[model samples]
Target: MSLFFKNYKPNTSIYNRQVLWRCNSTTATQNTEDEEEFRVLDILKKRDRQQKRVVRRIEVQPDRTTKMKPDQNWGNVWPGPRSFHPASVPLPLRQGYVPKGQAPPGKYANAELMKIPNFLHLTPPVIKTQCEAIKKFCTEWPKLLNSEEAIEKHYPVEIITSDYCHGSPSIRNPLARIVTLRIKLSSLNLDQHARDKFLRIVGDRYNETTDLVTLTADRCPVRKQNLDYVNYLLTASYHEAWTYEDWETEKTEQDMEYYNWDNNASKRSLVDWYLKVNNDDRSLTEEEYKAFDISVIPHGVEYKDAVYSLMNDGESDATIKNYATAVRKLLGLPVKVDRDV
Candidate 1:
């Protein structure tokens, strides 16, 4: 029985050792499979990295304006009106509401500077080019209008008007309807009667110092209408001045604004006094008057001019002394000499 039991135990132990060996072999196989799977995954990851495109970071260059040549045509760069662009202009422009003593912000990203209109497109070269392009459409200036006097003589009337442009929605300007017509009073061919009538008709529209007649017309709604209205007013005024009336003939010296020496009673009285003082007959023949040569009389023309000035222009101390001297000369009176007593 002892021998049988010992043999059974040995068989059992052998069975146990076989099971342990199997378990160990299975674990080793699992570890080897895991390591092969890890190697495959690593190969796939390396292949994916190799297939991807190479991404190299490239640095962009600075603005072209920074490298602009001095001799480049600026007009071609900026040909028309546009908002200011700091990157496009090579100028050292800066704008900002900075504190006192501090430098203004750089032009880059400056909202205040970009908000306003820029005249950089209207440089001297651009202006010259534009002028040359449009010059072909312009008419030659008239040779007759070379001098100021010639221009005034040819174009007696001057018409003035205004034009305006803005960014507002409405393009019409109220001031554009106003038309001013200016002319010189001396330019009108009128005699004394017509000139006096014109002065009376025009009233305060005439400037005494400049002798300019200005007529402003804004009653009409349009510029052309106002211009036409002013022209009609001017024509009517000129015709009215030329027209003669019966009452005008009866206008006396008191009614006249200026004195007329030729038509005055003083002239007739002076002639009569001179004839009486010289003991000459009023019925003398032209030959006899020629023989006397009355024009040679001292202070004849000067006395008339002085008297006319005294009556028309307000009398002064100088005029009074001139009148006394003329009277003394005309009357052939002797001058009183100052004697030492």
Candidate 2:
């Protein structure tokens, strides 16, 4: 019985060791492939050394204190990974949050991480046909601009003017005309809302209230991870509104999902609705709520009813005024600047 137990234990231990060895082998293989791909990227970048672009330099240290010899011109090798892929790095590293003692890993773990630089620059991969046309335009620009027939044909989107300090009359003049002969989005499978936005950008319609771009409110920052999903396209000066009624309905639905219903299940009072709109996911405590001005501004086109309700409930006029100011600031409208005498 003793002999059988010893034999069984050794066999079980050997099997466990075999499994561990296999796992290590698989991981090593993956790491080697990753390194080889990095090497290939270095080679491709070296080929494009003459292209006008930004170059990154990475310093390597053998350890925490010992300095690795400076390899200033390592045959034009691209900076390994981190400098190339900021977003691919874990959120902690991207946000500059490192644990007390751990060294940060390189931002990008693989070649797929190359998409990050494109995201940061807001540049998409160029279409092959468009690239070919750009090449042709660059090579024969002078003749094309001078041709009366070509001028009459007219391109869709053209550079009306630019400060070209260095090149031929076609390129160097501040008023050199370069037009995009290619139409990009006409072929895209865009939704109606996006299509309308495109038209507005190209100035195809009247009464367009939308701006092509807007700076986000600093108080409510956009998610760093989701920024890659943002639309990065050429917008017309004015065409049409991007959001249709259906889109607004959908937006309302999303907002409702975050709202909390009371235990009583009574119709949510105006006070409750007002409070929800005024604050984000978090809420002020009862004391904080007491400090808030529940009053509405009578002068504004909307919310006069709410202000009157708060005042009727005995909220101070000074508190209401301060609340109005806070509301404006929250909405990203400019705050009135005060000068002290």
| CA deviation > 4 Å runs, candidate 2 | 1-160, 163-240, 243-297, 300-341
TM-score of each: 0.60, 0.17
**lDDT (10s digit) by residue, model 1, range 1-341:** 99988777456888999999999999999998988884336776678778668999999989879788999999888989888888789988988788899999888889878776678999998899999999999999998789999999999999999997544557788998999999999999998778877888888999989999999999888999999999999999999989978886788778877787766666666766778777976764434443443365567777887787687667798787777777777777864444899
Candidate 2, residues 108-148, lDDT tens digits: the string is 45433343332222212223434666886675566656875
TM-score of 2: 0.17
Runs in model 1 lying further than 4 Å from the true structure = 1-64, 94-116, 162-167, 171-178, 218-222, 249-254, 270-280, 283-306, 317-341
lDDT scores of the candidates, listed in order: 0.82, 0.42
Candidates' RMSD to native: 17.8, 32.7
Candidate 2 whole-model C-alpha lDDT, 0 to 1: 0.42
Candidate 2: worst-modelled 10 consecutive residues by lDDT: 258-267
